[model samples]
Target chain A: MRLIAIFFGLIFLLVGFRNNQSIELIFPSSWPEPIYNDDNYPLNEQKVELGRALFFDPQLSSDNTISCASCHSPYNAFTHVDHQLSHGINDRIGTRNSPAIFNLAWQKDLMWDGAIHHVDAQALAPINHPDEMGSSINEIVQKLNKDVRYKKAFKSIYSDDLITGERVLKLLGQFMISLVSCDSKYDRVMSGKDKFDEQEKRGYELFCKNCSECHKEPLFSDYSFRNNGLEPDPQLKDIGRMKITQNRMDSLKFKVPSLRNIEFTFPYMHDGRYKKLTEVIDHYDRKIHFSNTLDPILEKGIHFTTNEKVDLVAFLLTLTDKNFMFAPEHGYPKDFFDQK
Target chain B: MIRSIQILILFFSLGVRAQDSIPVKVMYDRFEIQPGKTILFQDDSIRIDVVKFYLTNVVVGGSELSSGLLFDLEKDQNYLLIPISQIDEIQFTLGVDSLTNSNGISGGILDPIHGMYWSWQSGYINFKLEGIHFENGIAEEFNFHIGGFLNGYNCERRIQLQGSSNVSRLELDLYQMLQTLSTDQLKKIMSPGKRAMDLADILADSFFLR
Candidate 1:
């Protein structure tokens, strides 16, 4: 226990002090280095705290009703589990499933379509989205600037009282990048701390055989757009990535989702078409769509036995991290609202 | 895959950037706009209207091109003010800058505004046009919302300015755009199909420098 304490202390010292700011950057050694540079966007404790406060604060929305925590609940891997499709201010339902937002430091693009290139600019989407928060960054900052608590918080970290849109964006990025999920059973197994059960191990082996090509390990996503063999929803008519490229060849291809916490984040796909993991697996096993733009990988569905499917479900369950899900530190900082 | 990919993309986000030290201010439009007064133009005035088309891209007549941050003169505010210039000659696209279009954006550019978004069916409104024209002695309001972000009609228009840079104030002569199209051509465009494509092509060709 003493040895463990000292080891943790050493890690805190090394990673906790980046860019002269005290941000806790203690992901496991086995994980790859983060994509976001601390030098450009410093990760201070004050900034992280501010970002956390902002995440829970509804002032970022047009009305004081919606916040980041609304769609992305902390308990459910920072993504709402109750709703298949996410809801925002005035009960507006967004089409896409709210993705599990962990290990973002390794992510290059955001959203199901990978539309947002930077995490800094990512919040601006939900904030000003008419069907979402529907609040402008300018408007949100103006609200924060007027509030004495936020003004003090801003002054403590950024040194000035001005709450510009860029600062809001950068701070939100800091908080989001900090949401690293390196405590899954897969991570523990790789770290040599925990062992996978026989069923889970077999499921993982099957996963490696069939899913690992696109849903790559470590991060569990190759992050490329692929036509995952699902037929397009007739009502939505979303053309996936072809909207960005204007190329017919790229039609029906959406961003390959990260299957890290697939056990929790359900109502899957861009349109929230599949409600169950078994259904999703069955679709992959049988409903391989034959089209001009279907992913070659999914041209032929993988055949899985009934028992193997149960084993797969067992492996998927190992991804849930109770420590992370119930970390008291990430819960609503009651102290934040006290001053406001 | 994510690590190496992130490195490549990080290089781009960092590399494709202006000097970071100077948080400069760009006065988008200053002299062209006067508060408390709405500017008026003739139906026959030579006008060029530019929109920072969101969902779609900007291409010239045949090729995709860069969209510069040319300021709007009639109204001067520090926002992403759309530019309106005289019809001496013009060149411009209705989409984003090259680096931005390549890397992509989340909210500001792609944020849903007006009635341009196609619900959740598609993503963004790549182009928008609002024009008032004389049709059969009736002044009809014509609105062209062209965008789909993905697939065909990804109209990231490229434009070339033909006129010399003059004073601070620039004018939008609607008449110039009107001169290019007769009442018959103007009356036909509704969506980005064949006829709408022809009007878009005319609008693309109408861009010149003054």
Candidate 2:
């Protein structure tokens, strides 16, 4: 841990410590430190508020109809439940499902294929995608510069009215990192505030034996890329991590998404193939595609009884943090937007 | 004793200011670089629409002094000021380093608003050259946006040049560089790979101290 801190400190020093202030990350004491350090862009209330406003604003899209929340709504733990693939501006469907947006500080890489290395730069992907917002950071900066509200906010927060792409991206990153979801029933159970019933306890044991290797506890993700034995889609032909790495060994590999709020953040999988927990479990049980790059853990298909699947799903529901989903701060900043 | 201490402080300040800083200048030659300006070569006439690249890790006398600088042929901001006086040996990378590319978003020349950053991926476009080449009355467009940080696909080039006496400028023959690039394999290289690495090597070979 000391070595990691020193490494992060060296990086901060090398970058010349661009920002002077720092924000303290508040998570469970037992949870590991986030890979993302706050030294890059110091998180403050005003910056997060600006980011929240930008997230919900339709002006971010080229046609001024779509926003980040268009796909990632807070009510559904920041993932869209209405569709399998993400629907962007002009009703264009994207290739992959929009992943949920909580506990982002823990994620060293974003996107299903783990293309984006940092949360600060992740928004640029969807914002500039032709199927997504179809807007550039340059375009957004120009529009925001003209807005009186934004000008005032920028002046107050940054000590100047100048709005640059760096400030805009950092603000969005701050808002995302502020979304900490560690207040679920599972957390309460771990804290000894509550106890799981008989079926749920059995499900937890099964999960520890099988799923815990990849989907580690607390964060519920080891965050490594793996091929979880799914047949390649003929149309998408999305060779996943291979596209980034240009290596055949990395074929079909995708980042292991955190299972926190798994009950709400579905349909499951990178393509959102399954709509129910039982269907996902059945896929693990009966359908495991063998390939050279397939994860060794899923080589022998998991065999779970029908009753066991039901109990497993019951335990998975304990991960849903309703408090986080309904948090006023995480939602659209109505007060900021309503001022106009 | 206090007066002697004051004189010692003055001498120390003078010693600190004695080291001279020089501005690194990029001098282009053997080409008219304005948009749509035709440069007729053997059997082909090329019209360059855009040319931009990142110059980073400016080293003088084996010591690195600068981080990164974006250079656009159409823009007037062509020189980078560095804290070095002598021009004995100079070394610089033709693109942003892999470390900086992975370190996330930053301000100024490294900002995404500059249009050099790849929106789909998380790396800066190391070198961008877009143009139309005419061969046998046939005009084909070519875009070479070279960048990739991972191993086996890294396109950043480390270039070393023997500097002239008291001269801190580097001259690159743009026509020679373009001539060296075969038109057959020059169409739409927007991603990092073997082709991008090849182009980076060809471009890096074209730099010399002036």
DockQ of candidate 2 is 0.46
Which regions of candidate 1 deviate over 4 angstroms? A1-19, A22-24, A37-39, B1-134, B137-210
Off by over 4 Å in 2: A1-22, B1-29, B59-68, B82-88, B165-169, B175-186
Residue A322 error, candidate 1, Å: 2.9
| Top DockQ hit | 2
Candidate 2 TM-score, C-alpha based = 0.88
Q: iRMS of candidate 1, one decimal?
A: 12.7
What CA root-mean-square deviation does each model show from the true structure?
11.9, 6.6
- lDDT string for model 1 (A51-119, tens) is 888988998889899989888877878887767678889999877678888877787666777666567
- Which residue pairs in candidate 2 have backbone atoms (N, alpha carbon, C) closer than 3 angstroms, thus clashing? none
Estimated TM-score for each candidate: 0.70, 0.88
**DockQ for the candidates, in order:** 0.07, 0.46
- Candidate 2 lDDT over residue span A200-233, tens digit each: 8999988998799999998999888999999989
